[model samples]
Target: MSWFRALKDTTRSGLTVERKRLEPLIALRGTAGLAVVIAISLSLFGPAVAAGSAFGGFQAAIATFQRSWRPRPELALASGASLGVSTFLGYLTGSHLFLFLPLLGLWTFLAGLSWAAGPTIGIIASSNVAMMLVTITLPTTVAEAAGHAAMMVFGGLVQAALVILFPVRRWGAHRDALADALAAEADYARRLRHDPVAEFDPAPLMLARSAAALTPRQARTRPAQLHGTRGVAERIRPVLASLADPAVGVPAEGPERDRARELLAAAGSILDAAARAIRHGTPVTIPPGAIAAFRTPDNGTILSGPAQRAADRLGPLLRDVVETAGGTLPEEAAALPPAAALRRRLTRPRRPRAGPAARPPDLAPLTAAAPAAPPYRDPGRPLRRPTLFELVPAAVRAIRREARPGSPVLRHATRVCAVAVAGYLIGGALPLGHGYWAPMSAVMVMRPDFSQTYSRAVARFGGTLVGVALATGVVQLAHPGTELSAALAVLCAGLMYLLMRTGQLASQACVAAYVVFLLGMGGETWSQTVPERLVLTLAGGLLATLSYALYPAWETPRLRTRLADWLGALGEYAAVVVDHYAHPAGKAGPEVRAALLKARDAHIAWQDAIDRAGTEPVRHRGLSNAAADDAAHALHHLGRVAMLMEAHLPERDATPVPAAAALADALRTATRDGARALRERRVPRWGPVRAALEAWDGEGVPDRVVRRGAGMLLEALEALSDALDTDVPPMTVKPAHETDGPREP
Candidate 1:
């Protein structure tokens, strides 16, 4: 996913446990400024000249203020200054297209470029639009502009003060990230129980893992305390994945088989409880009976070796979940009888390779292992800080990419610019009152991809209609005084920000009301604006939607290419990680870690590409639904295998793993052939990778962990190969075990 997706206006799924639980807390960001407007109306301030101060606070709070000193003041000050300057320029440009067109072009270029920098730029984008549109119809002299500028800065300062005055815990979001992943894992377990051949959605778990991977780099969390969160998830993925495959997991159809399912379901429940605890940053609570009932190897009905093995492998994972919840041991576990003699009698010593094997990560300390997983980073070169200087260069780059013929971003930019210019010219030439609205809507609604553009345009159209209608009713019902109007506007602004991440319709509606009240206090009457607002908004929406339909970024033509991109990245990531496994010099070194991180980034892009491709008009979609499903499932399965391998690397090389290297090369070749196959309308032979995996020397590797990991690589390769031939559909793929197929580890 791109930075823009992460900055989603509303929180996706509303699953974040850290999100404010109370209504007032949700509205605080908006009210911080309303309080200022009230003071100004009460004559607590000298004049209405500084009214932009309220908006300044409103903008800064939207930046997600925290107790940290680094970004809050910086964002607040920058936004206030930008708002002041842009507002002034826009007002001046209102009288001249010579100034407006070029500046608008420059701002749009900046908006396009800022997308790579992350969600902050999105907030800045809204600010840019507001700066232009808010005062176009109002009289703005140099003196008024200066006063408004200062006032907005004052509002930003007020927001900063409030942030400092009211502090919240910093780990809330981080905790939720880990919790979300665990919960998703639990869900996966439940799915495995219900349908042995089922494959659960990996998006949520992937997103959560990615977010949790960043905890170390962010503020407030103790790095050591939580380092193992992702690592824990990494180890657990294969376990859950194994369960989803009945051939390698479930026992025979009998009471023993029933017992295995019950235990797995219980394990899922415990993990869910653990996720809840982590989400709330509290101790996990569950009945002691839940833990007690998890005891395995029961019923005296001998299960098939695979079923028995699956049950045995599942026990430690359940215990790990309990440990992660920061709860006391179960009553039975609290005072366990010593098993030293029994262990000596039953355990077989793992054979040494040439030298002593490095100690594998202990499962006893589950949280401690979480940090061991490689941290996520950009797969490509990291973006430089966005600046005004880069605007021209970025534009040049955009032109060049699009010049190659049909770049999505370039196409989108052209669409936006064209529609914007048309709206501007049409609005100004005709006496459409405050004609900027048409162009504003046009620019706001058009997106890089069709789905977002279409969806947003619809939302904007429906939202504006309702929002403006409500504002009109309220204004007519109560011709309130300036103070009351200002207060209402402030309140509406707060609600808008609160709903931004929760509901787009609500946010849009609140914003419409805010605009109405804001203008009312600024000496504009609702009666004169309603009809104009409706017409302008409708025109903007229509222009945006039809413009895109005419100049479409058709999905079918690009599906193969997008799929190719994902396959290529997947192969590269898998190859690198396997090579590292074969010849690991240091545990989790920068090179291997970087490769793994790069894979994560590629996976995000691939996922987005596939999703966007799916949304394209099916009539023109070149790919088959079954093929699309296979591609996604294979890619996701490979990604998890890579992640699991990345987390379980040994500290030092015992012997160079030739098998892993061979497997890596085979994958690269397959990937290359696969891409070519797509281009040539043919399927690639995937036998080399499967052969390489099968050729692995598990016996030559002394470390059980390393050997098991190697075996898993082959098993996954076989599964993916089966998928390519349509021999094993997602709903019926063979189960992967920790060892050779059908063989006990």
Candidate 2:
């Protein structure tokens, strides 16, 4: 009697726990039923509805998800999970009840649209509830509501079982991703060293370069193990302070202090180079001078001579890399060639030609080299915030140019709306007796960014397959009752949260698991139903792909026009640098910096646009083998000129030559050539400008100005000519230092 009582008590306890779990589900079912009745009654008694409410829900969810998900993988996972969870909760509350089924179908469709736009666990749960409610409303029976609720309980249980039992491996995947990124960076860096003007915005190249520099040991370490080396040079501050004190006895601090400072400086440079390389995707070579100083024997006294020598060598290199990376140049430097002595003379400053009547500025009167401007001060810190204003305008322009003239926004919106409507009508008309999948297909097919479209489709399919399989297995084994069902619901909620923390794949898996649970909970004894759900999902995916591929919205194809515009802007900037250098006595400040910043921003944008264009499969053949190569070369020359201008500003400002006219003439010639190259799709003539700048005598021009302007102009002309000629194939544009040896001081 005692044993029997104990058994009965255990059974009762289990039953009570199960009953408690079922309460929320019951309430959820009741709410869903009530919502459907309201929707139907409104549809029948009032004006006929055309599934607006359903479509709206689908649109809102897609917009919300797309807006939130970014390129960063971690952020993508988190946002996807959150949306999933939020969606599930909405179903539980029966909020937006009429739209719930539509959203579910939409989620299914988006999964096919792109890997990045797939449905989450939350979406699956919401869909299940919505479908159940829609079915229950067909009979308008209280018994139907109870039956659906019971089914939901069963579905939830099956999902819970899978989560607890399944072992998901994530660490390996993360490591692989990191490794791939690093490898890519390394390859890019190697390429940049060989060719620097191949592309603009070396950030990708630099990132790859920096990652390559990392030893295998470093690469293998977990993210947690790799302590952020940000501001690591700050640690050397105390040692620098100790060495600065003159009061300390020379004997006590001499050799050790000297060695320490040398190492610290070298280390600092290396760290800075590493940071720049990573941020800009450019390679940065350490100067030999710094290496020599760092290798000095340990001595306490500050090794002023060696340290100074190393610093001197490093200065020019550092400045060049920074300027190149930033897309700025000085006024007078010759086009960059092998690092060697190639003296160029400065021409006298010519007065601006007075309209058409003004005699061309006289080149007969050669001037002494212009005085150099003050050495440029480092901006101190790198610009971190990406300029969105510039990006947005460019994007808008591209979109407008690419779109059919007039009401692009309206056109796009109309097309999207049409797709949605078509999906809805078709889904409603399908004999499959479920109208959820059609609207889902529409949502998936409509996307602005095409890069992730394929991946999204694949992930969606894979996730669904796995989810259905798991659901099928659990339903067979559990034979879910109220207790089992309640347990499953709670488990699903927890898994949804966990999936949100994982990645897109995991999140999709959780959703799939939940869907499987729903199928089982509805008291459908046929396991074959899982296959039907899979087929429905695939159908939705296929429809989405067709929509994207057929009537796709595209970015503008006017890449050459954009490139020409940038070159023109660069010419104007070059003129500014030359003008500043011509007046040696002029003070240098924010103007130069501002010009440099603008040039940098423009260069980056140019590169980004090119990348986008390259990714379009239809345009790839055209882009890969077109005059883009020549155009890129010309831009590279412009970039070098900008760097040289910054480097020689001090010297240029001090020069006294009146050769401003010659400088202006050369700039005009180069600009015209660049324009012609773009118009005719041929290389520009760079020889005349190069020869003139190189041959000009700096006798009357100030030496400082001559040295600065001559070097920059010569280099600019060479680059422009080379770019136009197409004799030299375009290489990836690297940050200045990465391509060449360390920049000259």
* lDDT score for residue 161 of model 2: 31
On lDDT, the candidate that comes out on top is 1
User: Which tens-of-lDDT digit does each residue in 1-745 have in candidate 2?
Assistant: 1334433432332222111112233223322322332244234432111121221122122222221111122222232233334333334433344565454444433322222112332233223322332333222234433333333332233222322343122122332322333333334323332332223343433332222233233334323211222211111221222222222211224564445444445434543443444343333444445434432222313444322222232323333222322232333323222222121112211122111221111111011111111122322232222122342354344333433332222233334445554555665676664454444433533333333333444455566677667766777787785335424533543354434333334445555665454334334443545654566566655665555557653332445545655676676567666666556535344565566545554565566556545444445211233456665665665655454444334433253445654665677577656654644444556555555455555334444323444565556555655544545433343111101111000
Once fitted onto the true fold, the runs of candidate 2 whose alpha carbons sit more than 4 angstroms away are: 1-201, 204-269, 272-310, 313-416, 441-446, 479-507, 514-533, 553-556, 583-588, 619-626, 651-653, 656-745
Best by TM-score: 1
Q: How far in Å is the alpha carbon of 451 misplaced in model 1?
A: 2.6
Write one digit per residue (lDDT tens) for candidate 1, span 291-366: 5544432512544443444454455555545544553343334232244223322432221121122222222322
lDDT of 1: 0.57
Per-candidate total of colliding backbone pairs: 13, 117
In model 1, which range of ten residues has the least summed lDDT? 736-745
